[model samples]
Target: MIDMDRKLGRWRLRVWGLVINLVANAIALFGIVAVVEGGSPALLIIGATLTVVCVAALAIPPRSDS
Candidate 1:
């Protein structure tokens, strides 16, 4: 039972991570479009930074108390 619970938790974490990464990628794409259209580069910087952070976070697995 405990193992099943752990598996479920990990699955939930992966889904959330995937969702966050998708949003970050969308932001980065928007930033790229803005830059190409002559908009400020700040959005690109923000999006890239966020994307990097998210990727880094996704690399780390959740710690188990057991």
Candidate 2:
């Protein structure tokens, strides 16, 4: 039972990580497009900041509770 619970927890974590990464990439893409299309600089700044933050988040290793 405990093993099953651990597996589920890990699966959930992976799914969330994938989702976060996808969203971050989408934001970065939008930012690039906006800049190319002469959109606001603020949009680029916000998107770049979020992308950096997301990259930092993904760079951290998951904690092992062993």
Candidate 3:
């Protein structure tokens, strides 16, 4: 049972990491495109918000399963 919990926790971390990576990549891509294509204010705002979220995700420590 403890082993299963550890495995599950690892899996969850992997999934969360993947999700964060994908979101960050998507935001960066959009920012690049927006710069090259003369992006609007809305796109800029969205990009800023996503950047904050990504920063927060990295800054906050995850809770341990213990």
Candidate 4:
């Protein structure tokens, strides 16, 4: 029973994590597009860099502090 509960908790965590990640990626992509539209080379570069970082984070497994 305890094992089943643990499995359920892990599944929930993964689902929530995926939802949060997608939201974050959407925000980052929006920022990147906005920056590009603004027509500033330096800001566009910065935005692209941040977008890459955000995308890279999706591949990383989240750490548990427990």
Q: What Cα-based lDDT does every candidate model obtain?
A: 0.71, 0.63, 0.58, 0.53
How many residue pairs in model 1 have overlapping backbones?
0
Model 4 misplacement above 4 A? 1-11, 39-66
Of candidates 3 and 2, the better by lDDT: 2
* Better model by TM-score: candidate 3 vs candidate 4: 3
Cα lDDT tens digits, model 1, 1-66, are 122223445476556666777888888889999999999888788878888976776676655752
Candidate 3 per-residue lDDT, tens place, 2-47, comes to 2222244447543564467567667767777887898765655665
Candidate 1 residue spans exceeding 4 A from truth = 1-11, 62-66
Cα RMSDs of all predictions? 5.7, 5.8, 6.1, 7.9
lDDT of 2 by residue, 16-40 (tens): 5557767877777887888899886
- Per-candidate TM vs. native? 0.65, 0.58, 0.44, 0.43
Ranking by lDDT: 1, 2, 3, 4
Error of 2 at 21 (Å): 2.4
| Global CA lDDT computed for model 4 | 0.53
- Reference-based lDDT, residue 59, model 3: 53
Worst 10 residues of 1 by lDDT: 1-10
- Of 1 and 2, the candidate ranking higher by TM-score: 1
